[model samples]
Target chain A: MHTLIVIDRPPYGSWSGRESLDMAFSLAAFDQPVSLLFVGEGVLWLSQRQDASAIAQKSVERNLKAAAIFGIEALMADQSACQRFGLGDGTLIDGVETVTDLRVTMRRYDHVVFPG
Target chain B: MHTLHIVSKSPGHPRFLECLSMVDTNDVVLLTGNGVVALADSSIEVPSPLYALEGDIQARALTPDSARCQVIGFDDMVALTIQSQRVISW
Candidate 1:
């Protein structure tokens, strides 16, 4: 079964999003099919050059870079949310796909979970 | 229906808007907890075939419009979940 982990919270401000990312990695480690969908403020996690150092936190961008290496299937962002957040082709991190129809995209997975 | 979207956040929450955006015409929306507040908020445009938990409506003292939303008890909510091919809790 394909599991879709949806994160709608911004990174750094809360640990729930990070925890969700960790869960995705865990599922990947076990050879489970899992993909992540970022919507609302969660799309901010896909932005490039996020320097969390000043905030004394490890950058989520750095952690997400390892998602592919960890065998996570896909990293998706809501297109409208990306637009609202000003995340475009040049600003988003590499390998993140922006999806237009979220309802259709979500139905592809057997399970959908949200961060805290 | 294709999908059942369960929303527990208030209408003012960003996730509530996100949930609304993801709703398809064939999909059904169930309001629980703070989500039932949407029934009273006139500005929020809820989708058709909407449902609000009866307990939530009572707890919040909200009188949802009978025409616009169907109030369901726990058993009915479970039935709705079983009827849908997919369920997304937002």
Candidate 2:
């Protein structure tokens, strides 16, 4: 089934971001059609500047990269949300498609999994 | 059917309020992180079965004693991604 997963939290600081991504990756790893959207602070996971693994915790960056490798191509970041966080233009985060319209994209999915 | 709803944000964002407005006591609402801090407000109106940790709620620190539904740490506001489901965020 085609599943739409949304992640809008940062890494390590809290648990929502990592947990949600874990679910998304698990689904996609099993060959489920998965798409991930990042909004608010969630965009932090994609930032190339992020160093989540420095502390030995599960790395959001590594998970995102894994999701892409595992065929979870629906990774996206909210444009306005990026602006709100002062990450204007949201530093180029690998494996994420930054878009301006969240609601529209949200409506396109069959199953919306807020894995946060 | 038992449903556990976990939220990890304070009243910091409008989405948190939206997540709260979506459900009630029958479901479990886990508040952690900024969410644990958010609980201090008292007005959050979390529907019961509220399982929260003093820290990372998403990490699934506190487990609710129940069958049918399992407890998992949901990242901040990422719980809203499921279909036909309701969620609370920060």
Candidate 3:
């Protein structure tokens, strides 16, 4: 089944965003086709530089980089969310695609998962 | 019915017990973030086959073996999610 994991929260101060990616990685590991959609404050997760060491937390950027190893190549961010957050493609990490319409994009997947 | 229970907070957090209470014998419990630290403490009783994320373990510097729960990566968590009929996160 093709699953679209949605991340609507930012990377820091909360575990929702990283946990959502963990769910994506898990689904992709079982050879299930999975994609990631970052919206709302979640667009910030794609920031080019996330130094979490001082906070005594694992670098979320490292986890984001590991997506490819799990065979997850379809990473996307909501275009509107990016603009609202003043983040563009250039400010995000490499390989993140921006989608114009999330509603339209969500319909393509068999299931849409939200990190709880 | 097998359920996948996820706890993302430290122990003593209201949601931790709430998540644990929801688990059945066959359910799978996955601990992440701050919750991983609590899982490492031997005193707390875990109900089912428990798992902790490797990244969270490393981040907290907690030994998975000490906690007596299986240390799993994202892939293992994915497999567990697929096997369960329902999932509840806290």
Candidate 4:
């Protein structure tokens, strides 16, 4: 089954988004069909040039770069949320797809999940 | 309804706005826990066919506008979930 992991929380503020990423990576490790959908503040994860140095944390952008190598299907962001966060074409990380309709995108996956 | 969006976060929470943004006209929204705070928040424009958990509303000491939001009990909430084709808990 195709699993879509939804992340609606912003990065750095909490560990939930990271945990969700870990879950996606684990699923990909198992050769499971999995994709990530970033919505709301969660779209911030796709923003390029994230410097987490001041927060004493590793940058998520670096970790996200390994997703393709690990076989993760895709990284998607809500188009409207990206606009709200000012993440236009030039500002987003490479390979992330911007989807306009959240419902339709979600329905494409057999299973949908959100991180705690 | 196609989807029933259950929001348990407060109005200030990012998921609250995300849920509202994703809500379609045919979708129903049930506000639970801190989500009930949206009823009293004038700044947030909640979608129509909104329902707030009675217990949550009472706990928050919020009085929802009867014309806009219908207050529902646990049983009604259960019925709503069963009625909708899909349920999204945010």
Candidate 5:
């Protein structure tokens, strides 16, 4: 079954950001067709200049790159959310698709997750 | 401190990938409901102890009623957030 993972929280506000990623990788390992959607404050986690590791947190940029190794091919960023936040290309990780339209993708998945 | 790390998705996100790099393996990965789906993957490299919340068949495999599970919902996640030194939701 197809699954869509929704990430809505910011980088370090809560564990949702990390948990959502865990779920995405887990599903991908099982060979599920997984799609990742980033919305709201969640978009901040994708920025390229993030260096939260100094705060003793993991490097989100490196983690995102790890997803590709697991066979996950559907990382997506919400277009409107990005524009509203004034965060763009540099914020998102590599190998992620930017989705300006959400309805079509949301409807395609059998299971949709709100990871916070 | 006994920290609770809630994982709702697999393959992980950039922030989480960054977050784990900061955390030690002692922290627990709380996989609730749809979150339990994250645990089925053999590809994820996490060796952290994983606990599933209620409402998932997988949770039952871990424990009935998820008694051992770190409650992620059924209340404000922030409540538990205060109990522990931190709460990281991905």
Candidate 6:
């Protein structure tokens, strides 16, 4: 099944963001089609150069990088959400797509999973 | 198109209403996470047929109104997800 994992929470505040990646990787491991979509405050998950060592946590920046290796190439961020956080394409990690109509884009997937 | 609305929030949470408002009679609603509390809290009503994750229900020791909503396992959840034309989670 094709699944779209939506992460709406920022990293470090909770384990939800990283946990969502674990689910995505699991789905990909089972050979299911999977993608990652970041909305609202979740856009922060794509921020470059995140270091979580200060908070005694692993950096989610690593998870974002590993997404492509998991065959989850469809990394997306909501256009409005990125703007809300003042994030531009240049500020985000490479290989992320910014979509304007999130509702329309979401229909492409058979299922959407929210780990938060 | 028929949509599957997945609500992960309990009643009184803002996402619960946002999820309810997005679904209509033709859609399906699955209550997961803290959302299973809605089964006991009768104040919330979903326009579409409602189901709660069996795992969550059992974990919370919640006895859902079986007549109003059904309890489904993870396999059934996967089936429902594929059966729906689209899905959105809140």
What tens digits encode model 5's per-residue C-alpha lDDT throughout B4-79? Answer: 5555544455544543553555555666554564444456555345455555634545333333334445454545
What digit string (tens of lDDT, one per residue) describes model 5 on residues A4-107?
78777778767868888898999899998777788777777777877776688887777887887887767788888888888766656666677875655554
Which scores better on TM-score, 2 or 4? Answer: 4
How much RMSD separates candidate 3 from the native structure? Answer: 10.7
Under CAPRI classification, how is model 4 graded? incorrect
Our tally of clashes for model 5 stands at 35
Better of 1 and 3 by lDDT: 1
DockQ of 5: 0.04
TM-score of chain A of 3: 0.93
TM-score of chain B of each: 0.97, 0.51, 0.88, 0.96, 0.52, 0.92
lDDT of 1 by residue, B1-90 (tens): 478889989988878887898887798999998999999999988899999999989988888889989999999999998898877877
lDDT score for residue A23 of model 2:
78
- Model 4 agreement with the true structure over B16-70: per-residue lDDT tens digits: 7767888887989999888889899888888999999999899878988998799
**How high is each candidate's TM-score?**
0.78, 0.56, 0.56, 0.66, 0.55, 0.78
Cα lDDT listed for each candidate:
0.89, 0.60, 0.77, 0.87, 0.64, 0.83
Q: Measured against the native two-chain assembly using Cα atoms, what DockQ does each of the candidate structures obtain, in the order listed?
A: 0.49, 0.08, 0.03, 0.19, 0.04, 0.52
Q: What is the lDDT of residue B31 in candidate 5?
A: 60
Show where candidate 6 strays beyond 4 Å. Answer: B39-45, B51-83, B86-90
Clashes of each: 0, 21, 0, 0, 35, 0
Q: Model 5 - which docking category?
A: incorrect
Residue-level lDDT tens digits of model 6 in A31-98? 88999999888899888888888888887888678878878859999999898988885688888899
Query: Using DockQ as the measure, which candidate wins?
Result: 6
Docking class of 2: incorrect
**Pairs in clash, predicted candidate 6:** none
Model 1: how far residue B19 lies from native, Å: 2.9
